[model samples]
Target: MLLITNVTAVTVDSQRRIITDAAIAVKGGRIADIGKAADLAPRHPDAELLEGHGMLALPGLIDAHAHSDQALLRGAADDLSWRPYLQEVIWPLLSRRTQEDAQISLRLCMLEMIKSGTTCFVDSIVPSHYDFDALAQAVQEMGMRGVLAKYVLPDALFGRGESPVDTGGFSGEDESLADAERGIGVWHGAAGGRLQVWLGPLVPREEPPASASPGFYRRVSRLAARHGTGITVHFAGTIDDPPFFQREFGMLPAEFARRYDLLGPNVLLINGTWFSEEEIPILAETDTRLVHSPSANMKMGEGFAKVPQMRNAGVTVALGCDAAANNNCHDMIREMKAASLLHNVVMMDPTTLTAEDALEMATIEGARAIGRRDQLGSLEVGKQADMILVDLKQPHTMPIHDPIANLVYAAHGGDVDTVIVAGQVLMQGRQVLVADEAAILEEAQERGLALLKRAGIEVAPAWPME
Candidate 1:
């Protein structure tokens, strides 16, 4: 058992309370009690004490959308439009990655997330993972909670799904489904429910189909239902998605998903950058979830998503960093600031999305995205003791104004001094405890650059260097 005291707790609960001089007690991997430090100290007199004299405790941030592939290729494909960014840079770089390289990349991303106060994430794996054993092992070993989505491709259309240069992956349609099902059967509730397997289908026509029957879509939905899991797909990622869907399917993306039984409380839609104004309510009515990756959109020139409108319509919109290749960094703190400012400017309303709103997207709403709202995403008793302590004494994070506002607007990922998940301290005082940071960093740096080199890509500054 552990007790955290003398801290300010940003409890993103029903009342959105911020308790000063708060104390959070942990036992049996769950939050046991929460109250004023003075009141709780006597109750847990024998518990291991974690003092937070000048820190703020917030619910662990959740990355609703992420990619392990991009972590290895970050900064290797910068300053390119979406077209060349995909065709010329990303896909090619992905092809060069090895399975060993993948483990390193996964660790790299996990390390970054843990160091930054993210305890959970939903990763839309590219190409898809053939064997989830290694990935599952990595997650369990590192103690990070993740829903790893295997990219399920229609084998009839993409005979052999695009894969890494060295790692074997997705095959025929039936085989791919079987592989994914097998994964869920074996790993879905693995690691003491710290891991889950989700099915991912790329954006419609995003693969080489040019045309697709609803059969595959319905099959995946059924598969997910059978497994008691969820499906995540990119909805209207680009500006052309709406028109393409209309011309090809005679309906918009949300309507199409709804008809195919893909829009529901269990389904997660990424991007939603081009969901028509009419479709926003459809998303709300269906209780479908959408994740906003503002930095990724800005980097790829994908245009702004109507997040404020979606929120107003009662749609559950979460936040993510997407891929490091697109966003250059996976820190959700910076992503929150970017989201708040971006939407405000685009909507021409300074009050469009508040700092608190961005914080919720990364916290409580984020838990809602993964359908774990009750178990995680808030500092409440009986919830998983997943939390982070951000040092407010830092020079950059000073002023002692509204804690929520400062957290969303000012704190850097580096200012997160400690991270606790499942009542276990994974990182403390800027040092990781679950993995070998130095070895992982060194291996990933070399392996990542080698993958980029294998793809024949060169990364350098704009100006000449001697």
Candidate 2:
């Protein structure tokens, strides 16, 4: 049990309350009570007290779309376009990494996430070469909520009209499905409900012969229903995805999803960059969740997602940083700032995505996307005690007029003073307490270079070197 006072709480509650000089009490890994510091401090005198230093206590940010396997691949293919990077650096990496290398990468990514106040994340799938048990063990040690996805390979890449990827050594579809089912049986509810296993079915832009069986999605849907779990997929992400769908299905991806019963509250689509105007309403009507990754979309040079329009259309649009290989960081605070500004500029309206809206997306709406909003989103009573302390007394964040505005515009990942998940402190004063941060940093540097060598992809500095 613990007590944190002298903090301004951004609850992200139903009323979106902002409590000044607030006190929050935690017991049994849940927020037990919340009120004024003067009112609640004396009641919980025996609880462990953490000095907030008048910082802003907000719900821990959630990365809705992440790649646990790609953290070590950051900056490996800098400045390369989407197709070349996917072909040369990203796809080959699926075959090149060993299980040990994967564990190190997962730890490295978790270390960054812990520092940045990311208490929960949905790790997108990479490949089966990376071991799941080792990855789950690493996440268990860190104590953060992880939606660990089981990668189920398709018969061929669906929707891959213009850009085609090589799947030479990939496992067959039946074997992949069986392996994923085994993962759900073993690790679905592990880590005392702190971890969840979900299916990650990869969707490519190829035609019928290269695509999965016609009944593939319906089959996966039934599989997920039988397991009582959820499934995530990438859809309508690229410029060619819609064209491929038109040539194959005679409709948009959302229509195709409807045909196969894929649209639902439990399903999460990664990036809908090319989603047409008509598809936004379909997502809203079905309660389908979509993650908006502004930095990654901009980095890939993909057209801006209709984020403002989607939000206006009542879609549950949460924010994500994608992967370290693309955005080069796993900082949700930075991602929030990028999202708040990017949409405003794109819409040419300063009120497009407000500070409050962006923060809500990072907190409550993010939890909703993951189907955990009831237990994980806000700093309300009966919710999980997952929150962060932002040091607003710092030089950059000094003289804060509006806490939410400053958080979305002024703050960065380093301003996060503490991170707590399930009432357990994972990081304090920017120092990670769960693992050796220095050791993981060293291991990631070594393993990242070794992976490049193993893949025979030399990355020389553009400038001449001695």
Candidate 3:
């Protein structure tokens, strides 16, 4: 049992309460109680005490969309348009990754995520010939929670789905489905309930007979429902996405998803940047979750999602750092700040997305995205003890007028001094507890170069060498 006392607790609960000089008690990997430090100290006298002066306790951030496999490609494919970048860079890089490369990439990915105060993430594993056991082991060893899935591209109505123009051919469609099934069977409920396996289908937006069929999605949805897991797919992300789907399928992406029974409480639609206003109601009515990756979208020239509109329409919107290749980092604090500022600037209304709104997206709403609302998300009693303590005494965060506002707008991921997930402290005082950080960093640097070499890609620095 652990008891953290003398902290400013930002309880993102039903009332969005903030309690100063408070304490939280943990027992059996769950939040046991929360109240004033003075009051709780006497009750749990024997609990291991953590001094939390000058700290702000809140629910650990949840990243609803991420691609851990792309963590090694940061800065290698920047400054390119989305489609070309995907076709020319990401796909090719993925093709050359080995099982050892993936394990190293995921370790680095988990390191960054844990350092950034992220307790849980939903990763869309890029399609490749790799080892799931190694990936799952890395995640488990790091003590991070994740929703892991293999990326599935269904066979198009015309024939097999089209691969990247430069890449030779798409792999077997039956094999892709089999891999997804095998992933679920092997990894679902593994890691002592710290990890879950989901189905991730790339949205069918390209022209048809090259587009994914309704039957494929229906089967995916059914499998997800039967497993009591979830399905995550990219939908209406680029400006051309909606139109392409509309022209090919005679409907918008959301409507098509709805018709195929893919829009439901168990579905998370990533990057709804191009969702038509008409589709908002469908999403709200179906209780579907939308994940917004502000930095990635802006970097890729994909327009910002209509988050304010979606919120007003009663839709649950969450936040994510899409991938390191696009966003260059998996810092949820930076993602939250980007999300808060992007909407306000796009709407030219400072009141559009408040700090509280952004924090909710990173925390509770994100839990809803991966279907873990009941167990994770908030700092309430009986919830899993997944939380972080941000040091407010830092220079940039000093004179904190409002802790929640400062957390969203001012604090950096490095401000997180301690992270407790499921009653276990994974990181304390800026140091990860589970893995050898220096070794992981060294391995990642070596493997990253080997990966680029294998893929026949060379990235030259733009500036002069020293």
Over 4 Å off in model 3, which ranges?
Answer: 126-128, 157-162, 165-171, 207-209
TM-scores for every predicted model: 0.97, 0.96, 0.96
* Count of clashes, each model: 1, 9, 1
Q: In candidate 2, what are the lDDT values of residues 1-466, reduced to their tens digit?
A: 7999899999999998999999899999999999899999889989899989898999999998998789989988778667787887887875678888889999999899999889999997845557788888889999989998887766655334432443324446677788888889998888888989998876645632456345777778888989988888877888888988888878888888888877798898888899999889999999999888889888888776898888898888888888999998999988988998888888889999899989989999999998999998899999999999999887888789999998989989989999999989999989899999999999999999999899898888889999
The CA-based lDDT of model 1 is what?
0.86
C-alpha local distance difference test of each model? 0.86, 0.85, 0.86
Q: Write the per-residue lDDT of candidate 3 for residues 154-224, one digit (tens) a residue.
A: 66532444445212133545667777788788889887799899888766767333655788888888888
- Measured on C-alpha atoms, candidate 2 has an lDDT of 0.85
Instruction: Give the winner by TM-score.
Output: 1
In candidate 3, the residue pairs with backbone N, CA or C atoms under 3 Å apart (3 or more residues apart, or in different chains) clash, namely 158-209
Candidate 3's TM-score reads 0.96
Task: Candidate 1: give the clashing pairs.
Answer: 95-165
TM-score of 1: 0.97
Worst 10 residues of 1 by lDDT: 159-168
Q: Which stretches of candidate 1 lie over 4 Å from their true place?
A: 126-130, 159-171
